[model samples]
Target: MADQEPIALLLLQKCAQVEAAAGLVTAVRALHGPSRTAPIVLLTEAEAKTDPKSSSVDAAIPIHCPADHAARELERWRPVSLEPTRRIAGILGPGPIAGMIERLGVRLEAAMGMLAQERIDQGEAHRLAGLCGTLGFAQAHAAWLDLSLGEATSLAEARRTTRLTLAAIARGL
Candidate 1:
């Protein structure tokens, strides 16, 4: 058992004609020990009569469910965070995009601080808007546009909107 391969997810099929779920689970425990915490999901047809959970599996899902639904369910076992830098990396590969996002995030935070202090001007607002547009942050670009156009009622309001937009961009939206 020392040479047994580790399992990330154990998927078992449940069929009425042949019941192999319990035997498989026992084999897995024998190979990996009872301390193995890998998720065991049972795949079954929609009309299957057996209760999948009764087989001691973690979860039971239909075989033909939507891809996203299946992925979401599997995410409970292994979670991945899709941050803005990762999203941009998917488009441009892992290179300067991370540094670029970091620089832009820092700059956006600085701009917000400047707005809070009433030190930001229309020229800086226009520049920030252009940068945000080039970086694909549409909401931040819009906020900068409003600030540059003097549409914001006050500097505090501008800062608030800028903070919100920058937060949204940070969230990978």
Candidate 2:
């Protein structure tokens, strides 16, 4: 029951308010999944040039308000789900941890029991490290690198577990 909602992807392509646009994106992305996973599309003045057939996004929506209403839509997405994300909401206004989680401490307790100490893959460790880089979970995602420096027991197994943890965190996003 830790995560039961669907992911919601939001886009901030139509708002003229530069400040609010980023704030909205941070807020939406910070939210825990289970609703919809829409990435903020940022419908800028050159939105016509924005292509929709590109990445792993679910849906791209153009904000209507050049100033206020666009941000309002993101707020609306809130409260629609029962399991609210208070931690994510807090970061958007003061600071966004999109690219600074490397300095944070990682909690590998949950992942330890999921995968054994010998069944992991090194390539997977690289992949998980990349994902942690993306999620800004610096400390939490550093387990792969830290483990790589130790004795060579289940290095591969350790990394695969790390990658799985990264995937779970990403899905939560």
Candidate 3:
């Protein structure tokens, strides 16, 4: 039998803001569902603070990592069940991941351009970081983490770093 597309289960840990949440939505929407649906599970420590409502998520799970609630859920809930012929290819598999990167291309360029004109928001920066991780671009992800999470001193610097890193990721893709 042909290799069935692998099932994907994305577990996102820290999605607090609406814009950051929207980034996840944009990333997952790139999948558009196929032979099997890739479900997104949102986990948060501060559920009250984060608001846990986004269009892209299949399920929102509120729990403190390493805490009882999270442990119990991990024990009870299975992420996926594959048939004998099918296996898990992961969300970062070549086809879906490449597609996601392509989808983000226009947005990334536009965001970089906008950053030149005005200060970009944390959400936008974080969104780029999230996408980098999804694409398995570790260096790009680290650069984005530094910029979005305050390692960079200025927005301009972050934008410059992002643009460069995005080019690297595009080449790798």
Candidate 4:
């Protein structure tokens, strides 16, 4: 793989399709110079633990994390409001907008997964609310708003609400 290739993008879904496609690389390489190596590898928690292939990875950072952790660890952070983003997208075209939406989807999935795993705290609701507001995701925003507003008296309730929001987003509603 070229150094410029992304290291990986592990999806929650089963990666049999990826594996099947990977099996054809050699055949394609014979016709072309070389098939580009897909840097994205799908592995679940169980696979991460038992799969020897994972050992070769230099780093395996979780996309899901807490707000404080995100602030301290991530670089060059900034929020993009939806209206402005749409205006820019109109000028630039649908490509940029599609990429932005895809990125937001990934972020949401990661946050939801972390919340499910109990890896993040209630403050994460605020962080997610901010993200939803910036992204103009109304349903997600409502869920985060409820959690952040202390409508949920317990962490379990907050998680349940978060899960529902995650489901809604996943359904593209």
lDDT of each: 0.59, 0.40, 0.51, 0.43
Candidate 1 residue lDDT tens string, 1-173: 32343355677877773456677776665553312434466777763333222444556677888989878766644411235435667788756665665677678767855764556578888888887666666556776877888865545434434544444344432
Task: Give the TM-score comparing model 4 with the true structure, all chains together.
Answer: 0.34
TM-score of each: 0.41, 0.26, 0.39, 0.34
Q: Against the true structure, whose lDDT is highest?
A: 1
Q: Which runs of model 2 end up more than 4 angstroms from their true locations?
A: 1-5, 32-38, 47-173
Question: Each model's number of backbone clashes?
Answer: 0, 30, 0, 0
The local distance difference test score of model 1 is 0.59
lDDT of 4 by residue, 1-173 (tens): 32333212222223457565444433332332111212122233232321222222111224454556534422211212245446555777768656655666567656645544545445867777776666555546666667677765333433333333333333321
TM-score of 1: 0.41
lDDT of 2 by residue, 1-173 (tens): 21564343344455567667656655654655433223334444532432322322212335333557556634533321211222543556224543233222133322333233343345545555555544544532466655444435444334333433433344443
Q: Which candidate has the top score in TM-score?
A: 1
